[model samples]
Structure formats: C-alpha cells, structure tokens
Target chain A: MIAELFAGVSTRARVLLVLLAVVMLAAPLVLDRYLVSVLILVCLAAYTGQAWNILLGFAGLLSLGHALYLGLAAYISAGLYVHFGIGPWLGVFPAVAVCVAVAALLGWLAFRFRIEGVYFALLTIAFAEVARIGFDHIGFTGGAGGFFLPVRSEDQGQWWNLRSGPTFFYYLALLLAAGAFLLCAVLRRSRLGHRWLAVREDPEAAQALGIHINRARMSALLLSAGMTGIAGVFQAFYANNLFPSQIFDISRSIDLILAPIIGGVGTLFGPILGAFVLAPLGEVLISITGAIGLNAPGTKALVFGLFLMAIIAGVPTGLWPRLASLLRLRSVGR
Target chain B: MTLSLYLEVLLQGILTGLVYGLMALGLSVIFGVVRVVNFAHGEFAVLAMYAAFVLFTALHVDPILAAIPVAALFFVIGWLLQRFVVQPFIVRPQHDQFILLVGLAIVLVNALLMIFGPDSRHTNLSYSYDSWFIGPIIVDKVRAYAAAAAVVVSAALFAFFRFTLLGTAIRACADNLTGAAVVGLDVKKLYALTFGLGLACAGAAGAIMVALTDVTPMLAPSFTLLAFTIVIVGGLGSMAGALLGGLLIGVVEALASILVEPSMKSMVSFALLVGVLAFRPQGLVGKPA
Candidate 1:
C-alpha cells in the first residue's frame, strides 16, 4: 500500500527524498558531534515548523502558540518517565492525545468567537503564555526547577529505550525528520489540503464552494498539534530534559517557526531544507562569534529575523518555488 | 502578607500602572498614526537609560537633563527608521512590515548587546533614591518623579496632537493614508514624524525607568511584552487607552505580587489581558471596535 502511494509521488519529491537519504547517511561521518547536535536541533525545529505549517501555512489559521503543544508533550513524556517507569515509546501516544485535546479546545474557542487573523494570533499567544505560567507554577512539572530524564548506559545503542547517545539519536532524529517531511508532503496533496488552500485564499469563497472552514481548520489544528507532539517526544528523548522555561517559552515557538517561515512557508521541503541549512549555520554563528570574543545576544534569533525579512523583501514566492522554476520541475497543481 | 501591606502594594501598583500607561501612550501614538507596531519601541527607552547612565557617569549631568538630548537623538533615529526601513513596505503585504520591524528590533537589541554587555547598569543618581512620605504611605521619589514626568509628557503629547497643525496632519495620516496623501498632508513626513514622536515618548519613559530600575538590554523585552499587553488592553491605537491600560497593569502587577509570588506578578497582567480579551476585546475605555 505504501509502495503504491510512493509510486504516485512525483519525480521531484523522489529526488528530494534521495537527496535527504544521502545527507542522512553521510551526516554523522562528515560532521562533528557538535555540528551533528546542531543538525539535530534544526531537525527538531524544522519538524515543529512543518507541523505548524499544516495549520498556519496550509490551513490559513495562524497559531503563535504551537509551543504549548510541544512543551506539554515534552513535559508529559518526561514527567511520565520521571514518576512512573514507563519509557518514552509507550508514553508518546498519551502526549499526542493531550496536545490534540488542548489544540481542539483552542480551536473550539477561536472558531466559536470567530477570532480571525491578528486577533486569533494574539489569543493563541495569550493561551500559550497562560499555559507557560501555569506550568511554571505547577510543582508536579518541577515548577521552575525543570524535569530531567536519567541517562542509562553509555553502550552501543538502546533503541527500545529513549536515552541513547547523540549518534544514536541523530539517526533517530533523521528518521523522524523524514517522517515529518513525508507527513507534510502527504497532507499537502490530499483532499483536505485542497480545502485548506481554498479557505486560505478566500474563506467565504471556500464556504460558498461547500468547504467548511471551521472543520478544515480544526482538522488542521489537530494534525499540526499531533505532529508537534511527536516532535516534542523526540526532543525529550534526545535532550534527556524538559524545562518549562525552555520548552514552553515563547522564544522556542518563534525559533521553530522562523526556519519554515523564512525557508518557504506552506511548502513540503521548506522545513527540511530550512532546518538542515539554517540550524547548523546559526549554531556556527553563535559558537564562532563566542570564540571571537564578541558577546552575541540571541544571534540565532537575529539571523532568523533578518532571514525572514530578506525572504519577505526579495523572494516572496520562497526558495523552493524559485528552485522548482529554476530546475524546470513541475508540481501537480501549479 | 498583612492587609496593610497588601493595600500598600496596591497603592504602589496604581502608581506603577500610571507609568505603564505613560509608556503605552508612546506606543499608542505611533500605532495610532502610522498603523505600524514599532517592535523596537522598548529599545528607545533602553537606549535612553544607557545614554542617561553615560551622562551621569561621565559628565555628572542630571538624568532628566540628559533625557532631553536622548529623546531628540531617538526622535531622529525613529524618523529615519520610518522613512528608510518602514516606508517602503507600508503598502506591501501586512506581514512584510511586521517581519521587517521584527528584524529591525533584533538588529537593534543585538547591536546594543554587543556594545553594552549583558550586565545591568545602574545610574546612581544621588536624589533618585529619595522618597516622599504621604502619611503612612511612602513613595520612592524617583518613581514619583518618573510618574510625574510621564504624566507631563503624555499631557504635552496629547496637546500637540490636539492643537498643532503637524499633529493634526499626523493624525490625518494615521486615519487614512491614501486620503491624507490625497489631501496633500505630506503622508510620508507625517509617518516619520509620528514614529519620532513614539520614540520620544519611549525616551522619556527610559529616563524614568533609569530612576526606578536598573538599565539592561534584557529589560526591554519584558517591557515590550508589558507595553504590548497595555496597548492591547488600552485599545489597539487609543492614547487614552494606553494611559489607562498601563496604570491598570501596573496596579494589577503590584497587587498580584502582594497576593502571590513576586515572580508571578507578570502572570497576573497576562491573566487580566486574557480575561479582557475574552470578554471585552476593545478594552475598558476604548472606542467602538
């Protein structure tokens, strides 16, 4: 069934997949552990951004509060492990469920009140901030002290268990990143994706055309939240810690969005390409500047902002669309 | 704490809210006229604090005296930013200007961070620490002075908009860009001047901030959030809303601190924001939505 589905995918997507496979296979050998860690971070960010792209980019429902799901998932998984002896794999589903529920609640409230555009964005942010503060105050989540996953055994690999070495996690992250890209690619070409784009272009027109905007948006929200939850699970296992201040922080959400947004929002490979290139470069910038005796404050964020601005100013169509045009490759729709 | 202590905190919060309102007034002015949210508005205040610190340390100048030149310098910077950076994208996609301003904010903050390390700088002005006693209540003199300065600046700004030709032009530009352009109101100049005015308000706010709290690059980010919350609560582009909203937040924050953990004071303002948004999005004293 999957093979037949793969067969239907275009040549461009196939080429991109092969390229990603090549990079995945070659990364650990070519890159240093630090660089690989940065790559891992990028993958994590890209995955989150891709997840966000489903709701915000594709569905035209902007959510500035996606970090809430990410953080909540991380905390849930980490908290489960810390208290009960349940490993991350078994705990992942619950995390996703919790995040989806929360996302649904937000979507319900937003749709009920008909909060659209900037107001919706602000409300999402407010909700996330509320969750952040709530989590910060709650003692079960370690309040402000943060929750940590114990590192067990430094051997070859523990695939069944989550706490593996960076090399092990790197491959794991690569697999997940590939999964995120595939999820987006699959979603973008589906019937739902068409409805989403229609609604995004014109909500009233989409409604007139028999597309239910709320239903489409809510579905997008759930999928987006679920994907972000999965990424959070990956992040918790990979990092071996979850801090409310760090994970649920507004800055983290912003960081996650910057890559996909600057790379090319709503595109399938944008997050992958964006995270793969930008994440490592940003880490390098920070480390290099630190080495050169210049105190850089949020250099990554600054760079991301500038990159976003430059993209908006110069390449409004985004890198992938421009790349597709240059390479004479054609997508099915456009 | 005790009831009296609680009451005292509430009183202090009301005073602090007044200052917040003043800061929001600056943000409101620019947002009102230009319809562009200056993400770097808080940085103007930060820069002012830094400038004040420099003057106080180097030349032994009073902080207030230093603020005048600081505000003037910032006015020019703000005007230039609007003219060069912001004007090009005013008619483009809405998100473009937002992204540009966000980028500019990052650049400004990072540049400031590079110039001045992350350490908080205190402008140890001699009379800044003095306090006035009102019966049983005590008010920090610097805070009172800062609050008073905010009131004066806000009043003057209100008057400027109400009485001056340029002010009316700026208001006109704010109301309808195309219409103002049609009326030959120098829309571009008005936008730049409005931006300058916003920064000038921030500059004054910064001088007051130095007198009350220590100056640091990180300080502006929190103030940005506070100011944004105030602006939203006060009404998106209402000067009066900004004033009332700031004071409201300051009081809520102070009271929340007394009731709960001091660190959670900000959380209180955030809570109020959410509540207001859910029930009354336009704010308490705002015009029709």
Candidate 2:
C-alpha cells in the first residue's frame, strides 16, 4: 500500500521526498548542534504552518484564532506534567481532546450562524482572545504567570522516549513534520479534499452539486485544529513551558498564517518551503545584527511584512505554486 | 465601589467610549468607501497623536487647535495613499495587499517606536484637570471636552455625508463603487477624497486623545482592536451605525468593568463583537436589505 501510494506521487515530489529523507537522516551527523536546533525550529514552524494551511488554504476558512489550540494544548500537557507527574507522551490524549472540544464549540458557532469570509476570521480571533482572558483568570492553567514542564532525568544516552538532547528533539520534530506532510498528501487525494476544494471555490455551486459545504468546512476546521493542537503539545514538550500571554497571542496567529501564505496557500509544500526560507532568515538576521552590537528589532515581523509585499507585488501566485509549476510538480488543481 | 463611584466610572467610560467612537469613525469612513480594511489606520492616528505632541512641545499650541492643520496634512497623505497604494488593488485580490498595508503599519509603528521610545506622553492642559459636578456625576474637563468634540465632529461628518455635494459623491461611492463609476462619477477622485476624510477623522481623534489621555507607540494595537470592535458593532459601511455603535460599546464596556473586573472591559468589547457576529452579522444599525 505504501509503495503504491509512493508510486502515484509526481516524479519531482518523489525526488524531493527522497532528498528530504536523506537530509533528515544525515543532518545530525553532518550539521553542528546549533544548526540542528535551527532545523528543529524549521520543522516545528513548518508543522504549524501546514496545520494552519489545512483550514485557511484548503477549506477557505481563515482562522486568526489558531493560537487558542496551541495555547490550550500546551497548557493541558504542561499542567498535567506539573500537577500529576505524568509523562509528556501519556498526556497527549487529554490535550488533544480539550482542543477538539474548544474547536468544536467555535466551529458550531461559526457554522451555525454562517459567519463567512472576514467575519469568520474575526470570530476566530475573538475566541482566541477569550481563551487568553479565560486562561489568565483560571488558576488551574497557571493564570498570568504561566506553567513550565520539569526537565526529565538528564541522561544523554537514555533513549527511553524522554530524550532531551538537540539531536533527539530534531529527530522528533522531523518525524512530526513528515507525518504532517504525509497526512496533507493523503487528505489531498481523499474525497473530503475534493469536497473542501469544491466548497472553497464556490459554496453555492458545491451545494448545488450535492456536497454538504458546512460539513466539509467544519471537518477541515476540526482536523486543522487537532493538528495544531498536537503541534502545541510538541512545542510544550520541546520548550517545556507555556505562557498564556505568549501562547494565545494574535501575533502568533499571524506568524502561523504568514509562512503558508507567503509560500502558497493550498499547496502541500508551501508551509515547509516558507518555514525553511523565512525562519532561519529571521534567526540569521537577528544573530548577525546582534553580533555587530546592534540588535535588529522586529526582524521577523519586518521580514514577513516584506515577504508578503513581495509576494503581492512581484508574484501574485504564491512562491510554491509558481515554483511547483516551473518544476512540473503537478497541475494547478487535482 | 460606592454607587456614586460607580456612576462616576460609568460616566468616564462613556467619555472614553466617545473618544473610541471618534477613532472608529475614521476607520468606518475608509472601509465604507474603499473595500480595503486600512490596516494602517491606527498607526495614522498614533502619528497624529505624535504630531499633537510635537505641537505641544514646540509651539506650545493646544492639541485641539493643532488638530485642524494635522487633519489637513493627513487628509492629503491619506488621499495620496489611496490614489497610489490602494486604488490599484481596488479590483484585485486584496488579501496580499491587506498584508502589505499591515506591513506599512508595522513600519510606521517601529519608526515611531525608534524615534520616540516606549515612554508614554500626554498633553497636560491646565484647565483639563478641572471637573464639572452635575447631579451625582463629576465629569473631568478633558474627558468632557473629548466627548463634546466627538459629538460635534461626528455630527459634522453626519451633515457632510447627508448634505454636501462632495459628501454625496463619496456616499455614492460607498453605496456602490462600480455603480458610481458606471454613472460617470470621478470614482478615483472620490476614493482619494474619502480616504483623506477618513484620515482627517483619525487626526481629529488623535488630537482629542492627546488632550484627554496619554499617548504611546504601543497604543496602536489596543486602539486598532477597539476600533475593530466598534466597527463590527456599528456595521461596516454605515456612518450612523458607527456613532450609535460607539456609544453602546462604550457604555457596555464601562458597565462590564464595574460589574466584572477592570481587565474584562476589553473582554466585554470582544464578547460584543463575537455575539454580534454570531447573532446579528449585519450589526446593530445596519441598513435593512
């Protein structure tokens, strides 16, 4: 089944896949520890971007509230770890369930009232803010102070799943990114994907074609929320901390959308490509400028601003779709 | 809190809301005429506040008196911005351009942040410290002036939209841009003028804000979010809706803070946005179809 699935992928995608796999396998051996951390960041960002794209790009649902999922998941896992002495691996279920429940409530409100377009975007943002405020007041989630995960037993040699090294985190992130990519790929070929695309193009037309537009949109939203929730869990485990102010921030939501949007909204590789180009560029700019005794402030926001402008001015079609066409990866539509 | 203290807080809230409403009017005007969100609208208001600050420090001019020239200058800048940056994308996919405009806002914010560090500054008009005692309410002089200014300016805008030839042309564009174009209206000129008018409102609001409250570069985000909530509550394209919506939001936010906590005031507005969006998407005073 896996080989057949692989066989159906385009030649360029397959080649790129092979190249990525090779790189992932060889990165720890070849790259410096610092570079490995950077790559791990790229993976995490790519994962978040991809998860975000599943809703905004494919379903035509612009959710500026995704930080709620990230923040909630982080809090859930971190709280469990701090309070119960539960391991991160075992705490994934409750975190995911809570995120899904929150997303479902939001989705219910949104879909029931038919809050389409920019209104939907604003609604999502409002919900996220509410979550932030709620978390701030709620003592269980550490309130305004935030909660941090206790570090596991410090043993570089132990591989009993609580791995702590940069290499271990990098590998874990790589695996997660790979899973996200594969899931997106599978979803693109699924019935739901076609339905989502149809609704995305024109809801009335899709409804005329007997597709349940709302159902499709809601499903996409839930899946996207769940994926981002997992990313939050991963983030908490990696960073071992969760702050309400930082987690449920509007700026964080903007960051999630920026990468996928700058690369390509709907394309599978857009998030990864965007993360690869933008994340390290931001880090390098900050480090280089800091080294010269002048720290570049707002470096990430500035670069994203410029990137968004360039995409608007120079390439109206996102970088990934345009590049994909040039490389003959696939046609514009499935 | 005492009942009198509660009344005092509510009155203050109403005054604060009037200022908020004034700020939102500029955003509504621009959004009504141009379909663009004007992500840089709050930054322009902040810049105007800075301009007022300069007027206070340099020429020792009153912020209110300085508002006229600031409004005129910003009108021209806003007009030019529409003519150049916004007009081209009037017919195109505005998502990327909207992001670009947000970029412009960030640049403006950081530039101001760099020039004027994060220190908060407010113009201290000597008489502004005085208060008026009416029945059980003690309204501060500066806040009262801000509310009074909001009423006068909003009423003037209302009259302009309702009566003037140029205002009618702008309203025509707001009602239907393509239809106005088809009717041989100078759609481009009207758009620029509308944008200018919007920025003028922002300038006026900023002048009032400086007189009444502190100013800072960090004020952009809070002001932006507050304006968004007002716009959502007021209805996107309706001038009358903005005025009514502003007062309503202001009162609700004040009462919420009294009943709840101080931090919940923002939550109140956000909750209003969400509730209005879910229940009455057309907004409180939106024109009936």
Number of the top candidate by lDDT?
A: 2
Return the clash pairs for model 2, or none.
none
The lDDT per prediction is 0.77, 0.81
- Candidate 2 residues B150-269, lDDT tens each? 778888888998999989988888878778889899988988998898888888888778987789987876677777788889898777777777788888888988799977678888
Candidate 1: which stretches are off by over 4 Å? Answer: A1-13, A29-35, A154-156, A296-300, A332-334, B1-4
Q: Model 1 - which docking category?
A: acceptable
- Give interface RMSD for all predictions: 2.4, 2.4
Where is model 1 chain A poorest over a 10-residue stretch in terms of lDDT?
A325-334
How close is chain B to the truth by TM-score, in each candidate? 0.94, 0.94
Per-residue lDDT tens digits for candidate 1, residues B1-289, read 3765666677777777777787788888887888777766776678778888888888987776666787788789889988987888878755556556656666666667778878988878788668777766667776776777778878998999999998888888777878989988778888899888888888877776777778888777567778888998888888888998988899888877767878888888887887777677777877655
